[model samples]
Target: MWGTSRWVRRMAQGLVLIASAGLAGAALAGPTLTIGAIVPQSWPSTAEGEELVLGMQLAIKTWPGQPAPTLVIKDSACDPRKAENAARELVAAKVDLVLGSWCAIGIAPRVVAEAGLPFVSANAERLPKAPDGVLQLGRIELYIVEKLAADLRAATGLRVGGRTSCWMNFEPVLREQYDAVLCPVLGFDKKRWEQAEATFTAAHRRPFTASVARGYAAMEAGLAQLRRIRGGKSASNDPIMTIFGPLPPTDVPAQADAMQLVLSPKLPKLSPRDQAAVTQLLQTKACTCLADNSCSKPGPWADQPFVVRGNVPKCPTLAAASPR
Candidate 1:
């Protein structure tokens, strides 16, 4: 009876040790996801760079369990060569995924695809097909084209054929399908785009434009994908599909015909306060200095009042817009 009792005690101890070891292993096996980003950190797009970083940082912090990703960011300076080099560095760092440039994205795709890394572009105008390993998260082509076409018909009651408009900015293949009247331009509905831009700028207190908004939207899309990644699955496992849902629309100011103007529905929504701010901003007259002057040089628009001609002060616009 004594021997049997001693043996039973030894067995219990062994089980306890085994269980402790298993727990320790599980604790040490925490997931570590690494993500890399490339942006124009130098002159021309510095505000954009800051906004992009803020968006990604916000997304990561709000994720549950504080599953922080190791972020490696590089400056593209809005240059294709610089973007390519930055991508190569990210690939070398062995990041699981990549978020890339607003300006240089057109050229950066080839580098990302060669590295077999999954990527999201913050401001790509054109969409990409599968197996390309890249996704355009904001300001996508199809949505903009359709919306522009609809707006034109409403404005002119006729489609402008073979006309060099905003449609000209799109690829030849895409433009061919829209041989109608008055294709939308980049700021197709300038009045509406300005309103949306002002609203977003006021809300964020940063210089917001369509491209910057696209950068923010791209980060949101990336965060959504990161949330869906199952544990231990390869990050390369899925293709980034376009989220085709409409975000809440920002209202365009009243027009001659009361035609409702809005930014592309492809964009994500801004808050209610932001929408109101945009409405207020649209009431003000355009500032000649803000519109024509370059912010690249100091004191260009420094003396201008914050509330220009009854419009609430938002961030000033860039001198010359960067070409993506």
Candidate 2:
């Protein structure tokens, strides 16, 4: 009877030891990092926001790190109030880092910074000046507009009017008035962009946009910084400061057909000289300055412009009367 009791006790002790060992192994494995994302999931910028989230997810999946990070997404709905609330929620949840607040740049960055967290803005109309920890990944809207205007004027000698907002609603009308319309596109490696587009399309059954590319790049930049921090290679205490350094310019020769140009149906026939001028305008490179203020340099797709023509079904009534 005593032998039976001893055997049972030994079995219980062995089970406890096994469980303890399993827990110790888990402890050594460590928890995956949590990244907070605040993006619009409602009206206004819903499509762009969804693409941004998809891009971030793709970045996380493709990371070659030992333990991949996870995302905790909160919908900003493109509203300032909602974005502020979302920032608070992310802070409360103790996310290691924050990325986004696309349209709500006014409020979200401040809120996240106040909570002592790093904020990376993927898309903003203008760079936020007040927030100390904020880092912008995308180019400034006004700068792109100005660059396009200057390039067009220099190349075609045409007057260019700048519009900051309502691009989708007013583009058709604007295109009718203007000779050409230029927009900013994230400059990514051609092969890499193609691969990313394929992956995105395969998963979502639709094509991605500039917003998606921005989100992916922002996530990638953030992850790269995180890796540096983990490896004790980060130079600055602020991750934003460390990662905002100027990137080296690429030596890849510009491809002639790399520019995205769509000729407008309403466009009048151009002379050979005019056509050459337009081509020259399309090949002009734009400079993107780093957030660190270290350098102003063109990206890999510097010479490749993103030009879109007005998709108006019919030319304006006055267009017929006007001479080229």
TM-score of each: 0.48, 0.57
Error of 1 at 10 (Å): 6.9
- The TM-score of candidate 2 is 0.57
Worst 10 residues of 2 by lDDT: 315-324
Q: What tens digits encode model 1's per-residue C-alpha lDDT throughout 165-252?
A: 2221221121333323222223123443354455555657865544444544555556555555544443544543322222211122
Number of clashes in model 2?
Answer: 0
Clashing pairs in 1: 159-181, 160-180, 160-181, 160-182, 166-184, 166-185
Model 2 spans with C-alpha error above 4 angstroms: 1-29, 124-132, 141-182, 236-324
So what's the TM-score on candidate 1? Answer: 0.48
lDDT of 2 at 121: 70
Cα-based lDDT at residue 259, candidate 1:
16
lDDT (10s digit) by residue, model 2, range 1-324: 999999999999999999999888876555789999987777566766677788888888877874788899898877778888888999999987888756556578788888877777765244525465565654444245566566655656554554433231111233556654443333455555777778888888876666666677778777776666566665554433211122211222223222223344455566677666643333333212234432233333344434333343322111110001
Best by lDDT: 2
